[model samples]
Target: MTTFKKSFLILMLPLMAFTAAHKFYLSVTHVGYSEKDDALQITTRLFIDDMEKLLDERYGLKAQLGTDVESKSADEYLEKYFRTKLLFEIDGQPAEYQFLGKKYDTDMLICYFEIPKIGMDKIKSIQIQNEILTDLFDEQQNVVHFKIKEKKKSFVLIKSDTKGMLNL
Candidate 1:
């Protein structure tokens, strides 16, 4: 084969492989909410593109940056949308995830409750886990805060808080 033809085939092969892999990843991800436990529980994955579009549609604001925009503006917009939209649920029930009552040095989102009553004694323990992308501007800041709860004598147990990092 000619040199030019061989080089062209090699480059196109890798590019086609990359595109296929990306397509597979997107298909694996969940876009809308999924009902579990007979509609008592729901699990959903929020994509960055969906988040940006939702913010624009709901609040008439854009969180993501433009092709040729300032970084500071983009950061500020994303932070605001994240702070507003990130949430958690247990057994298909909504629970408070953002701490509205504390001032912190960093841009940390806190979800509290020494113990939240979800209307069932059968629930011996409840675990709230969240995966959020860290802020681009503040490397030290996290999108979620998991606070430790002290031991108390009760049939209902509220376990320790667990924090996680989400890579987008």
Candidate 2:
């Protein structure tokens, strides 16, 4: 009994430490379909603490948001990095990106975006899996909606359609 207890505690120590060091917020990814055009679009939002860090780590890149020699300073690296690093893909092709905007509210950052249209036939299926904020809000199997706007020339995030998906 003592030997088993010791082994269990030792195994849990590293996991507990990792959990303590990381703090995650909730987010959602909306994927919508249109039968008329046979198109699909995906919009994802992450309420992560360090978005810059997450983007850098996940994409394996260090992007500069803009190029303004006169305005570019060491402190402005994050802005530059984000401007260029924000990207998405559809059917394995790089989707066109336009910065819709960003707003800071209460402890969360809401980023809006506009992406080029994608054909739905290429998409296999929609999957919502959480790799970061598994502890805070995990829907496991949820429906995410990506709405199409004909006049807008872009897709809007509709909200989580199903579970493991956090709405907003």
Candidate 3:
């Protein structure tokens, strides 16, 4: 190969790969309130590949998430992981999370949870501590969105700031 050709290839290949690849470690957690049910509905979306990696490294659970080769106990592992890594607090008190279920959207695993007996009016301030993937990924970002009644609040938590407080 010519010198110019090799140089151009080397320069463009990494740029192309960087642009094409979207392997950013991120998770989005949405928390909303239900008046009728008096529940705080929560949904967390995580990259399946990222989750699988953590599961393998930390829990030794080989979950082939978002694939046909996924393990049968994938949900169980997910629940366990979330329970350990995610925490919620209302009015400086610990809140319980009911793991509803999960569904996959493309490469993301969207898990659902609910804080029952909690109404929007009753919440003075909502604090969320999400350390998911932070230990594994130094630059991991956990975006938390709260839709309590008509008020909407958002917090972007990084490895350094794993906990976010939103006053509603």
Candidate 4:
């Protein structure tokens, strides 16, 4: 190769190696009906950094998620956000859930919720609307898994299409 071409290639190689790639925005949620408890249990997993950024951008609160210096009202804000962004319709009727709590695992935050008095036999259909992080991140995707008895269904929710339905 010519000297000029060799020099250009060497200079560009290091820059290319150091350049940051686009980050993938994703969250996973599981919804299961418990026959023993007669309720629907929900768990959502989200990245700590992405959730912190969302809390700050949407609520103007600095939620240092999964850190010692985290905000005291972080849980409250989180529940509020989830209540708005995540929704459910059970058997053609709107269902409400109670935010149980949250726990941090490594770089992810896992939030728990439950809807009580939902008998598995009575549910003909269940619909989920998961818009987590989609307001701030255009490419955000929420993966949802629903289980009832021996039936299981999964969906990948995005900004444009944020709802999924499962019929037994």
Candidate 5:
């Protein structure tokens, strides 16, 4: 694991809210088409406190994210949230991404996903809609980076422009 992944062991609390002076809400999602695995691997990094707040508001469950006292149903809520907030497509066909799991480092929650059995050779155009955290924070921005073969591209997604298509 990378040092960033190891940072989850260091517990830290998040700011209750962003002030006018600090108004950026962001998440980074990395998607790579793995030739060896014949799958698209995804890792999304989000603030643990933000996710917990959403969970509490939606399911009335307080998820301690990286802590030992984290709710058992936390994963369930994550699954539901991602399914509703994110979507991926290969070419023009809808691609189904399976939620692998999640981990926490510091105040960030990293969620994992995989599009199984998807061959890299079959991709020409890709589409993505990532609305994570937009419901809570008006300024929430979801950044998606995709890599396939030797080509790579990225997108900045916001509430109004949550969906984007890339031609390779």
Candidate 6:
């Protein structure tokens, strides 16, 4: 109950609160070309809580992703959001991908996409633009991994630089 002790406690309370409130925002995406299927497969992993917040904030809907009471239009909004935020270009031509579906993995939401009929011989380079969760989180980072045959490349994309190119 001393004055010095009370002052120190007050000063430390804000610092403790700030430290506890800090969180890291990150997402991981994998893009691989399948020789057998002659297609490009993409998978993105995002934190379920972060994505739920984004769905609510961006679309004014309580998506409640991964929960029993999830919104019915969640998938539609997810596809719409991702279609605008994430993009790809193969050999300098815009590549359109089909949003296959999404699944929940523990604390993450994994989304599946595919660009069919993409032959290995036709791909000289690939450009990726991933802006997932960047608008909602200023410190968001999107880590992308590309695997084409035996070659592999990785990039860490942020709000400022959301695009990367990999050349074979």
Candidate 6 residue-wise lDDT at 20: 71
- Tens-digit per-residue lDDT, 127-168, candidate 1: 334323322111222223222223222111112222332221
- Give Cα-based local distance difference scores for all models: 0.34, 0.43, 0.89, 0.94, 0.87, 0.94
Which candidate, 1 or 6, would have the higher lDDT against the true structure? 6
Residue pairs in candidate 5 whose N, alpha carbon or C atoms collide under 3 angstroms: 8-105
**Candidate 3 weakest ten by summed lDDT:** 14-23
Model 1: runs farther than 4 Å from truth?
Answer: 1-7, 10-54, 57-60, 64-94, 97-123, 127-168
Compared with the true structure, model 5 gives a TM-score of 0.85
lDDT of 2 by residue, 52-112 (tens): 4454565544433222332234224433444453334544445564445555565445555
Q: How close is candidate 6 to the true structure, as a TM-score?
A: 0.93
TM-score of each: 0.26, 0.35, 0.86, 0.91, 0.85, 0.93
**Alpha-carbon runs more than 4 Å astray in model 2:** 1-22, 32-44, 52-86, 117-168
Q: For residues 63-122, could you state the per-residue lDDT of candidate 5 as single tens digits?
A: 888887988989998999999999998899989999999887888999999999976776
How many angstroms is residue 54 displaced in model 6 relative to the true structure, after the best TM-score fit? 1.0
Looking at model 3, residue 81 earns an lDDT score of 83
lDDT of 3 by residue, 1-168 (tens): 999999999989978976775668899999888888998899999898899999899889898887778889988888998988899999999999899998999988899999998766767898999998998999899999988868888989998888988787
Off by over 4 Å in 3: 1-22
TM-score of 3: 0.86
TM-score of 4: 0.91
Count of backbone clashes, every candidate in sequence? 0, 13, 0, 0, 1, 0
Q: Name the better of 3 and 4 by lDDT.
A: 4
Arranged by lDDT with the best first, the candidates are 4, 6, 3, 5, 2, 1
Residue 67's lDDT within candidate 1 is 31
lDDT of 4 by residue, 1-168 (tens): 999999999999999987878788999999998878899999999999999999999999999988889999999999999999999999889999999999999999999999999877867899999999999999999999998888899999999999999998
